[model samples]
Target: MKTELDYLAELAGHGRISRRAFLGRAAALGVSAAMMPALAGKAFAQTAVKGGIIKAGLQGGESTNSLDPALNLSQVTFSFGKLWGEYL
Candidate 1:
């Protein structure tokens, strides 16, 4: 998943940054967090609030939140640690 950032960061030699790491940094830089909403509003600029539920099959998933939940599940379940693709 070589995203726009992978190229940009690679140009800057930002090292091997995973998507999550890139997102965390971008949020810190106000890229996705602050700008995405604004861009969504400006780009779409509509009142239609389209919405849908994302049901992740929790049968086997990964959690990155806290160990409390991991304690009750496998370390390598379906690994719902994060998202990608359109949902991302």
Candidate 2:
């Protein structure tokens, strides 16, 4: 017979269940209580941290290239510089 944990795991795999509901059901079924916070913590941990500066170094621009936007010859460098320049 499949257990509640198995059902919960299936639901989780399908993205049809929330972490809180799954953990609550698991705990009700006498599953390890420790796993509740651990799983929740892991779920929260997977989230990305917000508001940080991102720097990228792209290679392609030649010495002749100027910081002037009109003189941009390399599309890659031009876009890269333009993107980072917005944050400055």
- Which candidate's TM-score is highest? 2
lDDT of 1 by residue, 1-88 (tens): 3365445355334345544564566565557565534322332233544565657655544444343434445534324333212442
- Model 1: runs farther than 4 Å from truth? 1-8, 11-15, 33-88
Q: lDDT tens string, model 2, 8-85?
A: 777765668787787778777776887656444443335445567757666775767666777777886687668756
Candidate 2 residue 10 Cα shift, in angstroms, is 1.1
Error of 1 at 14 (Å): 8.5
* Each model's Cα RMSD: 14.8, 11.1
Model 2: lDDT of residue 51: 68
Per-residue error at 56 for model 2, in Å? 30
TM-score of each: 0.25, 0.39
